[model samples]
Target: MAWQLEGTYFENCNCNMICPCSTSGLTEPATRDRCNVMLAFHVDRGDVNGVDVSGLNVAVVADTPALMSDGGWRMGLLMDSAASQEQADALGAVFGGKLGGPMEGLGPLVGEMLGMESRAITYANDGREHSVQIDDAINVKVEDFVSPLDATGAGVKVSGVGFPADTLAAGHATASTVNIFGLSWDNTGKNSFSAPFAWSA
Candidate 1:
């Protein structure tokens, strides 16, 4: 069977405003810290082979011991509570490295999987204004970029990376001091990344 999924997602990284991993070199915090990020996907309309997966929400929390390219990751997953057992299974398979998708490449780097939780995703998209929250691990609010800003006083914004830039999004994040399986994280700083993505099953 063959299936395709198209949706919108946002990621909040521990790096500066514009994470460099998307294009430039990997992130290296002074403490040699890792990158902690949360990705939330909103499926406008999608299907997994014969399974109807429209309107379902998926959230992935990941921690890379070092640069993402180095792999050795730890992850947790959250799904909408409204999904049925089958739906949950499908989502788990897709994200847990059970099914082949964009996530599969990260499988070898994964350790200490924290299983899955039931949660809801909320978003408010009003023109260039965007806000999203995932139960708790994520909270973002940002303004749309009409053009470029000037000088250092413009605040620190990292560019030269690739992500969904059309969602007109932004936000800061706060998470618990999380250490599950092989991952650990702290809730400090904000995050902002949005882009369109596709997946298969």
Candidate 2:
């Protein structure tokens, strides 16, 4: 089966202004003892084995060791409540790394699977800001870092990093909170990144 997905992705993590994990390729220890993060995606266009999955939202919540590459992570997946069973299952296969794609790179790091759930997910990207609300489980919003020297107000970005996207816009979380899977955090004012992503297999 062939699958393709294109989306806007963003994440908020319990790290300083610029997360070392992003630049260090997950080799450096996080600013904190643990890395608590929420990855949210809004699929603008997608298909898996002939099933359309456009306009759907998905999220991954993770708690990893300070040095992510050491590979001990507890993670859970959240699928949009609006999805049909077939759609959800298809997405699960792709995101769970069952089907070869970018996410497969992450499969080796997960030590525990907190299981998947269907929840109401709201994702918004209004150019300068990105926000996501997953039912009562998570709430977060990030604003891009705009350089005063640049008149166009584009976000300060970094490229050639080991991430899902080729380039990532640096940002900070204005409001962040999470309570799910026995993990809780208030990462307000922490590190954040946003980018457009495309994955196929």
Candidate 3:
């Protein structure tokens, strides 16, 4: 039951420029620190249990506290409405990390099932701008990079990480407080990335 998916997302977190997680650092955010990332998946061509998932979309809403290993976070999944019951179930299984895909490794850290919904996704990346909004669930914006002399939208890059491997990432993030699986977070600060990523089941 191994499938492949390619997509992008806009993540919001409470950290300084260049989130420590992206560089393999286990540093914690401020006292009220949190990490809430929204992953929007567009299954270019994938399936589960004989289900067709070519044009389907799914999302992963993850929240981590402080050090990200405290393991008291929550998750919520969103599936496209066009999918049939069987297809929806299959999509849920895969995105929920139950089918042993690239995201399965995070399963052990999941706190609870916040439930899944059917919604639309708006994802885009233009040169230095990256953004994605789930209709009304979440809205994230990536600011452009600043110049060294001017110190506008200063940008930085980190090697070896998830998707968008050689990321052209900026040093800023803007997001609103959100409630997913009963957890609330206004992930602000230096936690945003757009890099290349590749993982197998």
Candidate 4:
């Protein structure tokens, strides 16, 4: 079966100012010599197999030991509670790397699946900020970056990170919470960003 998901995604990690995991370039060690990241997505327009999966949300949270390049990543995925069994299965197949797509490109890096949950998920991008909540699993808020030289803040873009997209706006987390995968962190003021995305399998 063929599937495609066009959406927007946001992510935050406990890396220095920027997370090398997103770019697939992590020659140096991160702040903690590891990466703990939470990523969420909103499918404004999508379809899986023959099922319509629009207006749904999904997420993948991970804890990677050593540099992102070193792999050995453990992760958990959250699907939209409202999705049907068919749609849910499709999302899982895609995100789990069982199907081909951008995720499949990273298939070699993932080492474990801690768990999966389908619960109320929310992803919103207001004029000033972006926020995502997956039931009680996590809550994240990303704020845009501003320049000291310029008074009016501009969305910052960083190209060639680990994300599938060509570029992503740089952000800093205002609020971050996690309670799953035996991984826990409150990474406020950490590396954060958002960008549009498209994936197919």
Candidate 5:
């Protein structure tokens, strides 16, 4: 009944094929020399301080200065409108760093919480391609990549990084949509990935 979660997310950022932020973080300089990103998550199983939060989705829009290790990120949030008020409130607390857990470390990095909105979040996947929609403001998709060794076309993966996901499957953005926080871009052809994650505290 303590706070715990198991989930997956796909992130798209304005960077080269592979994002350095995921591997080197801020210490090794950004892929494009900075970090601006949007990510969406589907919590298959979760709870916040005993509040059940299964089968819900959340999305975040953010901008960062320099390395993420140095802190100074601004963020906006979107929680699934289909969720009950309690579910939405619990998700807001975690996403906003109020409840803490895997997101606790993010607290120091975030300089501002743009806001949280309850919206219709459509998160889905069709085998290889992943898609997410937040109301009419954001929509994006990423397709898993084929690893060099995995001839079966399994997704490229990496581990031991600072991202919420411990092992993430790599991919590229197929579409990137934005209309929140003055952030705008079509990140298709940019860096992207997804991973199953677990966090407890």
Candidate 6:
């Protein structure tokens, strides 16, 4: 079975501005002793093994050790409530790294699977700003950094990292809070990033 996804992605974590994990390829220690993060994706167009998944949203929440590359992450997956059972199953297989896709690269890092749930998700992207709300479990909003030197207010970007995107718009979270799966955190004013992503296998 072949699958592909093209989407806008954003994340917020309990790390200071310009997260060391992102810059150091997940090898550096987090600003805090642990890294609690929420990553959301808005699928503009995609399909999973012949299942249409366009316009849907998915999110990943995780609690990891300070050094992410050291593995042992407790993670959960949230699927759009509107998805049919077939769609949800397909999404789980892809995002859970059960399929041989980009997400497979993250498989080794997860030591605990927090299980999956269906939740109402709201994903929004307005220029340099991105936000997501997952039922009552999570809420996060971020704004990208704009360099004064550049006349265009484009976000400052970093490239060639081990993240989902080839380049990510560096930024900080304006507001972030999470309380789910026994993992709770308020990472407001911490690190955030956004980028367009395309993954297939």
Candidate 1, residues 1-201, lDDT tens digits: the string is: 766677777666666554555444344431237777766677767776577778777878877764666766667898877778887777777767677776676677776576788766675555444556665555555443443463433333335443333222343444323343355565445455565567775
Q: Count the backbone clashes (under 3 Å) in each candidate.
A: 8, 0, 12, 4, 0, 0
Q: State the lDDT of candidate 3 residue by residue for 5-102, as single tens digits.
A: 55444455555666676555334453345676655555556657667776666667776776666677678888877678888888888777788865
The sequence of per-residue lDDT tens digits that candidate 2 reaches over residues 25-116 is: 88899999999999999999999989999999999999999999998899999999999999999999888999989889899999999999
lDDT order of candidates, best first?
A: 2, 6, 4, 5, 3, 1
Cα error, residue 69 of model 1, in Å, equals 2.4
Over 100-192, each residue of candidate 6 has an lDDT whose tens digit, in order, gives: 887798899999999899999999998699999998899999999998898987769988875688899999999898998888999999999
lDDT tens per residue, model 4, 66-130: 67667788988998998998889888888888888877877788888888888898889875588
Ranked by lDDT, the better of candidates 4 and 5 is: 4
lDDT: which candidate is best? Answer: 2
Candidate 5 Cα RMSD after full superposition onto the native fold (Å): 1.8
RMSD (CA, Å), each prediction: 4.9, 1.0, 3.7, 1.8, 1.8, 1.0
Cα lDDT over the full model 6: 0.91
> What's the TM-score of every candidate structure?
0.73, 0.97, 0.75, 0.92, 0.92, 0.97
Which whole-number lDDT from 0 to 100 does residue 15 have in model 2? 95
Global local distance difference test of model 5: 0.81
Error of 6 at 36 (Å): 0.8
Stretches off by above 4 angstroms in model 2 are: none
Q: What is the lDDT of residue 9 in candidate 4?
A: 85
Model 6 TM-score (2 dp): 0.97
Candidate 1 to native Cα RMSD, angstroms: 4.9
Clashing pairs in 4: 22-161, 22-162, 23-161, 23-162
TM-score of 5: 0.92
Off by over 4 Å in 3: 25-32, 45-52, 82-86, 144-155, 162-170, 175-177, 188-190
How many pairs of residues collide in model 6? Answer: 0
Error of 4 at 88 (Å): 0.7
Residue ranges of candidate 4 with Cα displaced over 4 Å: 24-28
lDDT of 4: 0.82
